[model samples]
Structures are given as structure tokens and as C-alpha cells.
Target: MSNPSIIFIPGSYVLLPVYQPLFDAVSEAGYEIKGIHPPTVGLSSRQGRESPAPSMYDDAAVIAQAAEKLADQGKDVILMGHSYAGIPMSQSTKGLGKEERRAQGKPGGIVQLAFISCLVPAIGSSAASLLGRFPNEKRPLVSIDEDGWMLMEDPEATARMICQELPPKEGEAIVTGFAKHSAQSFGNQLTHAGYKDIPVSYLLCEEDLAGPPDFQREMIAMIAEASGRKVDVTSIKAGHCPNLTAKDETIEWVLNVVRKAEESRPTV
Candidate 1:
């Protein structure tokens, strides 16, 4: 079977194009690769936003829209998200499962849910809810005002922490590209628990300062404990932004998972 399409939902404060290297590599391998900048991130102004500002559900809707477009074309998808992206990406797959969609006479659906050093806040929980509960040194961008805007006093520190494994210049550029993300993204409760039915995999960044190895393990365990599913974990010695620091490795790992998911898919 051919490799399935892979859609990547990037983390907070990051532009989707930041994953260009990974996207190029994955696409060069003859697979469809796309990345989305969630609405919750990088909004120049929230003065025109909804009453409470964009939340995880808003982000999930964007992701689900992309997946639905591909699935409608009879293309299977491997939904992969990074860092804070996992929360919304999890909700994006509701009713988009192969079996579920097929029952509705749809041509395609999501095959797997993949993550790279991400947060999987349980249904009814928000990323803000998990703040300070886990031990992490590089927790720079946490609190936000009622305005729902979070600005980094020292974006340099965040760049160094999240993309420490990358080149010094590259890390600097990454920080420059960061925008003020919505605090409501952290506080809003996640509505869907898509992982309960979908197959899941995690690419753990062992040396991530922002999201420590221990925290990643706990997230994996949370999925296992809550869903009763063993999340396939592949650890990489990289920082939080593995797609940039360890670009080659990230591309290859993504290809492997997509291939596996495509191979195991039941024909509709």
C-alpha cells in the first residue's frame, strides 16, 4: 500500500512554515505532507476575535477541516501534531475515523494520531490546568492576562530552551518568528478524546527542556491509562523542536509511522 497523507499541526507561537524542512523531506518521499497554523496561534489582533478569544476547539476545527478535505478525496491521513498541538489535534479526529466515516459512506478517514514532544491534556482538561504540576525548568510562557494574550519577556530564553539543539542562528530566527499566542488556548477545556479509538504514536524528545523527558513519559502513560492503549513511543535525543534540530531524523520517523499506518489500514 502507498503511504498515507500526513498533516502536521504546529505548536503555539510558531508559524506553520517553521516545519518546512520536515514537510519538504516527507513530501520528497512521495507522501502528501501539509502543516497548519492553528487559529489560536499568531493572531495579530484578538480585538476582532470571538467573545473569549480563540480556544482549542477553534484550533481543532481548523485541523478537522483540513483532514476532511483530504479524507473526502479518498486519501487516508496520518494526523501528526507537535508540542501544544496534540491537545487540539486529538479533538480534530472525532467522527473522522475510518470505520465511523465509512459507515457514513465516506471515502477516507484518519489512520493514526502521531505526536512530537506534545501535550495530551485529557478531555475536560486544558493545558493551563496542567501548568506547574509537572517539573520543568524551561517554563517561561505560562500565565496570561484576561485578555488571553501571552507575551514572552525573554523570547531568547524560550528559543534556547525549545530549539536548543538547533544551530544558534536558527534558534534566534525561531524566536523572532514567534507571536503572541492566546492564553485562552491554555485555559480552554478540550472537548474530544479522539485517542480512545485511534491508534497513537509519540516521538519523545529525550532532552527537551521545556517538556522534560519525565513529563513526556507521564503524558504517554496518561494516554495508556485513560485509553487502555499502548502509545507506540520512539525516543529521539533532541530538544522540543525536533522537527528543526533533528530534521532528518524527524522526517524518517514520520515516514515510518505513516507507512505502518497505511499498511495496517483495513480496506474500505
Candidate 2:
């Protein structure tokens, strides 16, 4: 069998660079790793001034395209989504699983999904709704720009909410890198629940203030109930950004998931 490839989808307002450490670690472990920087997060200056900003659907399409490219090369793909990215990650892998691709005469497709301190919404659920807001209301954590983009509100708020456990300087650096998020993404609903058919895992960040442990537990339970299957879960004592605050533990959990996926593959 070909070596598996892992594609990482970062959280809202965060670019691929934010996960460099985790990427390096994964690469060093002898697995191929790719990071998808969604255009919906407004990282590109070209999208900054565009009207009718991009949505989560656009983000999912980008992710799906990347996965398809790897899958075409006969690489078993594993998707790792962090924070708000869980939604897109799940959506992108829908109907693109190994089994589904094999039926379509393709070489490979997504084999597993890993959600790290992230939203695990049901089909047709929007991020804003999952975060405890009614339709057309402001999202819980961040402030919105006049042009329909979302901002981190402030560095202090980001520190308190997402990276409380990190060293002060490190947390500050993360905040400084925050970019505007497309407000439209929050209202876009997921069309498919990939976890229902895919092997799934969730890493609960116990010390996460932004995505509280209790809520993460609730999402896990909900997913299991909806999918009618168990979701492998592991807990780590870290802030929302476990890849940064608890790098070693996060990588260990990721590797464990990969090993399990490999074990489950059929022998020739």
C-alpha cells in the first residue's frame, strides 16, 4: 500500500503557517503532510476587498480539490481539522472516501477524519447556530467587520479565549497573525455529515476556553448518536490550539489515529 497522506485544515482566521510546528512534526514522523489554507478565511489580499465574501462551501471545495489530487495519486488521505475548520473538513471528505472512490474507479480517497478542539456540527447546521447563536445574530467569539468579515476582536480576547495556556509571547504572536474571516462562512450550513460514513476521531482540549471541554463532549455525543457509530476520542490538557500549546501530546494522538487507520486497512 502507498504511504498515507494527511491534510490539515486550520481554524478560522488562522493561516497554514500557524501550524508549521505540527506539520514539521508530522513530516518528521515519515508521513506526507499537506496544509490547506482556505480562501474563505480572507488570508489573500485579493479577497479582502471583494464583495459577497467567500463561504464555508468555498472552503470545503478547496479542501476537496486538494484531497482529490492526492487521492488520484493512490495516496490514502487523512483529514485533520482544527477549531472552526472541522466543518469544512467534514464536508470536503463527503462522498470521497476510499470505498466511494474505489467504486468510482479512483485510486484513493479520504480514509479518516480527525477533529481537534473543533466544531462537529450535524448536517445542515451552521457554525453560528452551533456556537449558540440564532440566525442573523453575531457569532459568539469574534467581532465582525463592516464589510462582512470577522476579526479576532482584540489580542487580549484571543489570548483569553483560544491560547490561554501558551506562553505570553507565543500567544501574542498567534494573535498577531490572525486574519479576517469571511462572515458568510458562519452562516453556511454543512450539506453532508462525513463522520456518518468515515472513520472519525475527536481530540478534546480540556483547557480550551474558546471551545469548552463540556461543549466538545456534547458534540462527540451528538456525532455518535447521529452517525450511529462510535467516534474515537482522546482528551488533552491544553488550550484551544493544542498543536501549539501541547505539541507533543497532540502529535502523539494524531499518530495513534494514523496507526489505527493503517491497521484497519485490508491486506492484499
Candidate 3:
């Protein structure tokens, strides 16, 4: 069997400049890994004024381009979008060419899509619209600090709010790098709607305060309805950045999806 290639897409505000930990985790399980580093508002950018909006389209382009490359190598690719990355990846895989689609082991040509605590947009919905539904009165549990560096506002409070299930050390690292994202990015509705026609699975972070559970349910239902197929769901008891704190377990669940996807492929 060929090694499964998975692409790690990071979530909003947080800096995943390096995906080696995730890469190592999946590789330890016998899978090859790569990451799509979309352009982001550097952590140094001033809050509100910085731009995370362009990164969405930028990331989608990265996903699409990466799929083409993997297909050329005859490797099966799985697109894993964490946090807000789901929006770009879900949009990117809609209408790929045969070779591009097959690289992800999607027999018809595209491999399956996975949403990692990432919001799945409604057919024409924007990320901002999804957040509006959540009450903003409470201060953010994680955010950027005064130096333009990202950090958790209150470590203990944040741990309780987002990663009560994770180890203290792992949770602390996540909060330490919790950068502030551009508010405008969420408001920009995805221009692509191909996700409705592609195979998708979603991983939910049960304790996430950023992309809350209620919203995840709403978004998942909407994606399922739009695709005319049920969206697969898996749960991880962490915050928005599970890939950072729950790497091993998350990769295990992802492998399960990959196996299922491989089994469902038709002999061509």
C-alpha cells in the first residue's frame, strides 16, 4: 500500500509556521505529510487592521496546487483543514481534474476533505456570518498580546474553556501562541461552492470556544444538506487548535477516514 499523504491546513489567528509535530505524528502512523502555509496577517500586524482575508483564497490556491503535485506523484492526498481552513479547502476541491482528484485516493479523481474544528460554510455563507451567531459580549478566551505576539488572555481560564481535556503543558503551548486574527477575514464569504459536490468529513472539537459546538452542528448540517450527502463527524475534546494539542488522537481518527475512503473507491 502506498503511504497516504495528508496536508495540514492551519486555523485562524494561530501560527502554525511549522507543522512538523503533526507531520511526525501522522508519519509515525505510517502516512506521509505536508502542509499548505497560506499567506496570513503576520502576528506582528496590528489587530483589526491586519488582513487574514486574502489568506483564504491564498490557501485555497495552495490546496489546489498541492493536489495537482501529489497526483503527479501517484500518491493519495487528504486535505485536512483546521479551524477556518475548512472554508478554503472545502471550496478548493470542488472541480479538480481526474489526476488531481485521484491523488487523494478519490477514485473518481479527488480524495476526501476533512474539517478539523474548522467551520464548514453554508453554500454561500461567509466565516463572519457564522461568528455573528455566537455572542461576542464575553472576551475572547485566546488572543494576541500587546506586543503583537499571540498569547492566551488567562492561561487557567482558557484551559478550562477550551482544552480541559488536554494535558496542562499541551494546552499551555496552544494558549501561548493564540494570535489575533483579522475580523474582516471571517466576513468574506467564500467565492467557491464546490464542497457540495465533494466527499467531506468533519472533526469537531467539543470544548472549542472559538468555533462553538452549536455552530459546528449548524454548519455541518448546512454542509450535509448542500452536498446532498451526510457529512461525516468525529469528535476531539479540545479547543479550536486540536491539531496542536491532540495530534496523535486526531491523526488516528483521520486515518480511519482515509481507510474508509480507500475502501469505497471503485476499481478503475
| Total backbone collisions for each predicted model | 0, 0, 6
Output the lDDT of residue 181, model 1.
78
What would the per-residue lDDT of candidate 2 be over residues 129-242, giving only the tens digit for each residue?
Answer: 887642323223566667888776556556766888877777877777777788888889989888888888899999987778998998999889988989899998998988
Ranking by TM-score: 2, 1, 3
Identify the runs in model 2 with alpha carbons over 4 angstroms from their true place. 44-51, 133-141
TM-score of each: 0.90, 0.92, 0.78
Candidate whose TM-score is highest: 2
Q: Hey, what RMSD does candidate 1 come out at? A: 2.8
Query: What is the C-alpha RMSD, rounded to one decimal, of candidate 3?
Result: 4.5
Give model 2's TM-score versus the native structure.
Answer: 0.92
lDDT of 1 by residue, 1-268 (tens): 4558888998887776778888888888888888887787765421223444577888899999999998898888889989889999898899898778988999888989999998998878888776558555546644455667666656667778888877777777667767667777888888888888888999999999888899889889988887888999999899998888888889889988987887787675
lDDT of 3 by residue, 1-268 (tens): 3655677777765555535676676677777667765654344322322432454666677778887677667666678877778887876775563444556655433567888877777756777677777666654554544433333457656655556667787666655555555444566678776557767788888878767887788888888788789888988777766666677777688778778777865575
Worst 10 residues of 3 by lDDT: 44-53
Give me the displacement of residue 165 in model 2, in angstroms: 1.1
> What's the CA error at residue 170 for candidate 2, in Å?
3.3
